[model samples]
Target: LAEKSNSVVDNDSKRKIKDKGCIPGLPIDGLPVYTGKEVAEHQDPDKSVWIIFKAGVYDVTDFIQIHPGGRELLLGAGNSVEPFWKVYSQHHNQQVYRILESYRIGNLREEDRLKEDRTQDEMESLEFIPERDPLLLVHHEKPFNAETPANLLIQNYHTPNNIFFVRNHLSVPKVEEEDYSLEIEGIGLDRTYEFTLEEIKTLFPKHTVTSVIQCGGNRRNDLNKVEMVKGISWQLGAIGNTRWTGARLVDVLRYCNADLEHPEIKHVQFEGLDLDAKSEPYGASVSSVKAFDPLAEFLLAYEMNDEELPADHGYPIRLIAPGIVGARNVKWLAKIILADHESQSHWQQNDYKSFPSNKKQASPEEFAQAHAIQEMPIQSAICLPEDDQIVQIKWKRIDDQTKPFLDVAGYAWSGGGRSVIRVDVSIDGGKTWFDTELEQETPTKRSTTTFSWTLWKSEIPLDFNQLRNTGNQIEVICRAIDSSYNMQPARNEEIWNFRGLLNNSWHRINIKVV
Candidate 1:
């Protein structure tokens, strides 16, 4: 027709290039180039949707509805998708990158390309994901929040790293281990101290601490059963036991020349590399007392289950504040501060706090007054039968009496190093109770307590008459007592809060007892 391009389009070359996620023939350079100004003009839905990933420009107008992130994909409509990808770490995979490449229309103009990308290689590196266990019960995918399945959770006293529960508030950071460093500073320190990953490994002695890391909202779903609450509907699987191997925090602080005894030093705040929209890293803090206490067993853990820490669980470095709620055990740790007061971060001041039942609205003044959740409450959960699972009644000797029974098993543990002492089961819904055989080891260290979880199993007598009265259905409820005899409440109504945190009420499940 009018004019044919000078460069001939090789059909085989085009097919191979297309398979590698690139255009065919535009000016014979393979793709058209557009400036940032041209791309910015397509923000309106009526025009088209253009987004940039690294130096590549993609037209995702047709892929909008099919995006796994749903409508949130529109967040990157007319700008760089880096911000969205930072919050949604799930997109950092080769498969996702290939899918994104399918919509590539052109390249960003070199003049308009990011200064940081111009000098880099054409290909972008993706993060490694080794903990994509199929057994995990995923609750959210954006930031990758998942829990261990109940049936698999109680099978091992020490949880496997691959199957361990993962809780992330922001995107999991992709930190290069070779360039990793920890910065320690604040008012309590004589001066700031920075340690490279190698220096930390060589400087401090490796200490193994067996502990249980549990989310404060471990049983938030139970509280939701009472009324509606605001948070991830986590079941009992939001906890796991692990043998963390790392350097003691007290030792690290001392090496940094921090004045542990300084009266002004009251809190130890931690910040992670994962950031939010404002580029602020995830932050939290714990009391200086717990940070320095020998019994507290604080650690700068780099290994989980005697292996290198998983990426989702905090690869290079993470805090292991035993007995404290998981929220305070910040992952992908970047900085630590010793100060006179607690961290002023959003998580510490507003989010992880629990409010009373009478408090209806989440007001700023009220959140400021409310204390942050540090040590988690005592908790236990049924693992064997599972909720809504059909269990067959078998004849067994329970409490030395031969009767129809259901084999029950679960896990229990308490915060502040409080060992789980006893577990009680009730088939009649708290009308009566039976003791369970607890499988736990006594603490060996003089100054330390058992920070690990307690595994308990029991056989509960099932009443056929009671099943008939309840329409062939029965409820299994359980509660645990800590070393201090702290027992869980019988009902979730007793501990219901607006945020639905610390739901340590009786762990219950309904099953068909036929």
Candidate 2:
């Protein structure tokens, strides 16, 4: 035996010391530290992979049974980065970096070393299957999965309570409407008042606004394929257009009985029920100008799609700031604070800011140097028959509403209150174009236009007898021009980011002409 050393292993001390020439033990740092890539490989066979993310030092032991995949996959790796980062990237924080540095010996791979070049054929031969992820709302009980389609979303005025997507950063508290009360803090007497849902209905003048709440990460999947990016793999469905009915937040601000001339007030803060790893609640803010603007269309919405709000969707009350990213739509009526400073929550001070293509995981000091992403860009998508298909087509006249026919429709909206002006549809391979019969007007401010999706129907021009004899291919393409004249980028590479977000490419569908 050569020697003995001391190292911390899973909170227990292990003793081992190694010498140079055939000695006993090596230092704790000499142990092979597993990376995210390694954890993924180990769990691929049986998903019960428990990887202790070396960075966050998180106690994921309890989450094993609750994991959607299975406990087996969450138990595979110990003290590793793969499973944790892969599943919890959105929850990553500064503390995680500190934990990683404490254990890292050095860079596992040397940058100067070069390996044999991979041929194009070799790279092309590799098979990759993307993981489907659940949607993470700032605060909710469960993250809603994204396999739903538009017709289903529009089946009713309001999405089903259970079917409604859940985006939460913390556990859903059992809040009772009768026992609930809203507290308004800032420049006036701090007061807590309670009201019944029915009392709120009769007390305040009811207003209705059709609005679309879209996630900032709506098209991020497209961004990710171009390059490694941060954030969620949100599909296009991160957006939903719904009718919101409530009292204007501006009205509430006035009712709070604050002095209008208060000079110290600079920002309006909104807090959600979401909590951090340390049980800190997530919060964010907007400028007092934006929050109090008469025309901002911000609402303390109590009803969605004309029904009682669902539990998954903030339940009794939630803030609805149309045209703003989903994060600002704080769920679970908590507290609204007017402050001389911005929100102190982790999300407001740390995340949701965009960076240049070259930056990655910059420090808070560095991020503050960049601008926050307040408004989303122009984007559109086709919800009819996706990219490839075999389908039964029933042709009918546009004037005949009674007949069922193949209808091509989709949703389009732009950030900063821009409206979709025109949508062009091409069914004959884009060789020629036809202006879709679009709705003549835009929806309410910050509201998603449902009928404007340009659900076009064309009678298969009875003149294709000759072409029908031979196998034919039908290619459909759709694009939108927004009020600001901004259009979707022609390719994904143009807007690629390290963190996959904002993937708005022209949606096309190809079908066999059966």
Candidate 3:
């Protein structure tokens, strides 16, 4: 068999292989080379198959069993780069190869590369058990915390109940809605007011507004290069725009006998249903100016996107404060307290606050001096056609057949009700710029805007032959100019911080031509 294989290979060198004629030794059958996009797509269980990866390293540790189809198929490849990778694409980065070295299966034998029947033991003990695919978002192949992508953000008025990004510190609690009661207390009041969900909803004027909620660390993933941060590697999707309708928090404060306009009060405290490892619940505090400002539009929302809040996004009742970091949108609303000082919950006192741009986990005393992450910074990201795609088109064909290989689109928003005044897109790494048309859907006030984050777009014209001729490389970047005309820094290094928060540099992507 060795002699036969040697002879076939030796013979093939004598003949030139054409695009269509190479069968047994065809690229797909021989070894696969995959782009990041292709790997993400094939990770789908129903459609995923064993493709021979090129002889190299591959990091499969994190992807092991979360595979919806199971792990055996991948484990079956053993350590050889042949059979499976024959269909998988090869990564080009040395860093990626270095990481993959930790998970290599083993070397392969030519004969073992042939297909074999599965044994009963191998078939029966499918330990994967067909449970839910643990990778919440298909692309990342990991649990959904904060790091999910922006474009992956569901495109409804409110994020779809199922896909709303989850940023849980502990497992979600299964509190019965009927048993739930909201407790409100003000430092000046003699007693706390406990109201059932029904009572709160019926008591206040039902108000609804579509607003975007983002985690303060929405772009923390981009900050890891400077120094390690201590929290979730949330991407832009930590934000979701939803129509929240329910009782105004102001009204609730009024019922608690709290003053509407007062100088003594400084902060409003909120507690969630989540508990720490020791069973202590989580809570946070926002300033009185942020919480009670008529324009802030805070709410004890019973409905998200016109429906009861789903369990993942704070079922039954959740505090919905538009234009603030999601950490303040405490899920499973439990308590609201008015005080001269901030809430004493661990989240308020420790976790959610931001350190000095120069500090790490500051001491408690140092933290006392630090400020909490209230509103998010100006930011944007491209959602469609993704980061890298090999698009085939003729420059002439581009006119009507295919939109320019490069179409820029994404969302942009600012903190403190600051509207995004302009958004710019550049296909050549910002060498040249073009202003994109903003899609304004509703009337935007200083606090509320018809455009939450202005979704902007632009197009580039390229002929197919040119794309194929150019080796298919193009860079796309986007930047937002807010009401203050403060543009995101072009590079991340200038704004690097210890907690990896607010790294909103111009987002860029590169794609190949096919």
* Cα-based TM-score, every candidate: 0.76, 0.66, 0.68
The numbered model that scores best in lDDT is 1
In candidate 2, what are the lDDT values of residues 444-465, reduced to their tens digit? 5554433222223233342255
- Which parts of model 2 are misplaced by more than 4 Å? 1-147, 150-163, 187-202, 260-263, 392-407, 426-433, 439-475, 508-513
Worst 10 residues of 1 by lDDT: 1-10
RMSD (Cα, Å) of model 1: 10.7
lDDT string for model 3 (1-514, tens) is 1111101222233232222121222232222233323333334333332223332223353444443223434543323333222112112122223333333222222333332213323423432221222434432211125334555553543555455566654445666768999998876566889999899889889988677777766766667656656455566667666678889988887777777566777888888876543456678888988888766788888887788777667767888877777778898888888889987765565556655567543555655566777777788776654666765532435336634545556777776667888888776667777877786446544534432556676666544565565667767678898887778889776676655667789877677755
Please rank every candidate by lDDT, starting with the best. 1, 3, 2
Instruction: Choose 1 or 3, whichever is better by lDDT.
Output: 1
Candidate 3 residues lying further than 4 Å off, grouped into runs, are 1-135, 138-151, 154-157, 355-361, 393-405, 444-451, 462-470
Using lDDT as the measure, name the better of candidate 2 and candidate 3: 3
As for model 3, its CA RMSD to the true structure in angstroms is 14.9
**Candidate 3 global lDDT:** 0.60
Each candidate: how many clashes?
0, 29, 29
